[model samples]
Target: MLAQYLLGKFRALVRLLIQCVSPRQVKLETATYLRGSKTSELDDEDHNVVEWAFSGAYDGDKPILIDAENPARSLSKNKSLDLVTRLSGSFEPGSTVCLHLQNNILYPILVLAILATGCKWTGTNPACTRSELEDHLRVSRSKYIITSEDHEDMVFDVLCRMDEDIELILFSDVTVERPPSKDGKHPTLHDLLANSTFLPLESRYQRLSARTAATLMASSGTTGLPKMAIRAHGALVCESRSDELQDAHKPYKIRRLFCTPMFHAYSFPKMVINPLRQGQPTYYMQRFDDTFIQKLSLYSITDIITVPPILSRLVDQARGGDAKPLLQSLRTIICAGAPLTVKLRDEFIQLFSNPPQLIQEWGMTECGCISRAGDLDADMPTTVGRPVAGYLVKISQEERVEIPGGGFASELLVKGPQLMDCYLGDDSATASHVTSDGWYKTGDVGYLDARGRIFLVDRAKDIIKVNGWQVSAAELEKTVLQVPGVMDAAALSMGHSLDEHPYICVVRTDHGVSEKEIREVLRSQLSRYKGSRCELQFVDGLPRAASGKLLRRKLKAQLTHREK
Candidate 1:
């Protein structure tokens, strides 16, 4: 009894010592950097993501993944695991599996099956044009393409043109009762799942280590063509584990409504691993449409992870006063992908009767979610909160010099377990983005506050320099969006690098607001150096990627072509 008491006291003392030694911000040499309050040791674990995800204790018969389009189409834990085990025998080890399908109930299951078989998985947008699809296939060097019947012709054509002997597989919605492939040339996912055999519990399946590449997520090609980012099993496992730890303290259960594309990195891990691990019911929307507001109320969705454009649309709908009651069931709205402006954040929160916490997270395809705003930091509108567990953040100027807190915005650098292994097949590109010392240059210009909160100014490449002043395009775009008649806006630099000018493209409402009025508003709200010489062009709509990031390079190319 005495020994037991002593051991308990020793554990308590160790916990107290750790708390005392933990610092909110660490000083490294002359620069101050921020480290996550929590640290995870799963970075070096030699385990496959599939094994880690399924190891969680959860109800096997619970309907955790449901289709919002057809409520009857749902997957319980047992059903999903069964499908995964059966389909795991289809792929050979170390081959790449590419998915070209829209958001559906079966997508996540396919992702799991691919990873379980010791193969790399990549997904392309279903709506990609023929050439774009070909480019993706060429870059990913995918050995097998899994697509729906709707896209089979396009996929076949692209494969034929490339003269690659890639196998093609067809997928159907979970609700469909697909027949076996008549020709046997291309098998359906259902056909694979119906196979009686399972993967041998022996040496046939290769063991996956932490460093093994599990996913090849395509980066959002905002600047140019998309590159496939290789993510290791350990990285994904670390990311999911971090999120699970963070949510462990929450008081209420999370019932998520996921409308974001499953193919993108922003939503991939969350959709594939989180719901099952947490034993939470997640509704999958094929696409965000007119029925979104009603579905939220019908399902009593407590949480949603979406992009800013969808939130803006929701805020606009809330103006009618009907959406207020429908949205009251929501307890949290986590926005990522593109920047969420202070104006939109505040406006949207105020519209809710019982306002849901609108949290903004900062991250990219190359890295998983870097930071997320907490409930306490919600009032600090512009901040993306502090770094999560296993992340270190710093700022770099011209010579890797760190500026003091609240000083001018510098390029943000992050080191974390969730960082992608490499830009797949592009070693030079990987070296250019990541420094030798292990810091990943985010290419985003932001500053760390004294409190260690991060505030994103703009993408380093998107900062427009006019005269001697550096202006943030995101800030300017935010200001433009506040105008009453403006529905959407994007800011671009229109001149040479040394001498650049701001050009604002806007999509106006039917209210028919004039250009002079927008300029007047900008002139009143912004300084002369920031807004005076701005040029405005009215357009029907702005082009954006599936992740809601503005396609600025594509837009600039279109504008330049028109001028020519």
Candidate 2:
């Protein structure tokens, strides 16, 4: 045992030395599959994720999580662990617990408690409509749901519609006091935590394995209805450590402002798991709004993980007046979920005298972050950088032929420790996406550069053929966004595949730009064949998922209904 322990430490030291001395360089053409520089097999032990999280290098007394709205309410590492132990007895082992609340101080602790009790966890957007909530509940097959008082009616209505006997638990704000529950059917979280017996940490079930499903996050569902993606404990554990190779050499203090929805996979591990493991302090905002700039200045936040739309909003706010003072404390902005446009990236950088580093990440709900552009490669803003440690990426044509570097755009296939175990209860769907050889089809179309950097073009299903040439809807939308007055845009095929033309739905500012001017700009910016047969429609807004992904299918369906 001692020799094995020393060997494991030696291996970790070697990996760190290699990463620090010379980062793994990607030799794109050396093999059919491109692997990251650092690699290791994760231990597939029956370790609970909560235990792994608490075993990090965090101070017991320092505040780890704070409620931005009510600064007084916070949790340190020790306090959080105690809360998790107390709440663990409230859940049944092996049952699924669903959270339907916005970002709050107790969100991460609640997730830990649920996992600690050997319960699988999932979350739905609190703003989801009845139908959407019904779909989520039905798919997750949750036995209990925890929601806030504001959304209790909606949850009850959805439960009634589904006719499922799922127990509902109201989540009370820790900062505010509320009367005890009058109905036995629904008890508030505060009540449960107070009344439930505290189970000794060692007395809890200890049968969890790496393959145990820890979370069931809903996919972005931009193409259709959302599907529950099953993420195993091992995958999430690997994902939480993804940045170690890049960040170990430069350990800096980070005070993060986490406003992104916690329900989405993009924010889940980053906000809940990483902060605890890294000993970083995070302020939780219920939602983002006009006061976002104020909150940044108020909290003196150093870093943020967000999407492109929020950055666009910041750029617009900067244009109104000087924003450097409010944003002066920000050191880094990690953008993911959707592709970041060059125009927006440049504009955002120009906001500060000393611009914070903007790192673009690429991944999906089925997998945690696949790649991230580090500070060293910040100049290449267009690319999503190379695959991070433990991930292998390859580009493949529809016929499963591997494409070499600098080839045309094809579907991106990835094999990684962070890949989802399966889509919950959907073997057919899982089989269709994961190949027999274990590559997970990403459904994204992009090519790797000579340096092994990934440049995403568009979704495979979103590509339209015009005049026998394939065109990317994302590329078209990016071009449209370059127009001065365009605030938002979505590009889609207007007709059948063989005879398709680009149709752009745009939301414009008060600048009053004409469709003719936009067409002229597109003609100058894009290929003649790609731009000539384009149609434009000005709308107030475009449909988008909670993650800021364009709902192209929804937009197409709306247009089809209008044409009918």
Candidate 2 per-residue C-alpha lDDT over 375-402 given as tens digits, one digit per residue, 9 for 90 to 100: 5554455689888878999988564334
Cα TM-score of candidate 1: 0.75
Q: What digit string (tens of lDDT, one per residue) describes model 1 on residues 78-179?
A: 887777777786877788999998888778788888887889999977866676677678788889999988788878888888978788988855446666
Per-candidate local distance difference test: 0.76, 0.76
TM-score of 2: 0.75
After superposition, candidate 2 runs with Cα above 4 Å error: 1-32, 41-46, 174-185, 220-224, 399-406, 462-564
What is candidate 1's CA lDDT for residue 544?
A: 96
User: Per-prediction TM-score, please?
Assistant: 0.75, 0.75
* RMSD to the hidden true structure, all candidates: 12.0, 11.8
Supply every candidate's count of residue pairs whose N, Cα or C atoms clash at under 3 angstroms.
0, 0
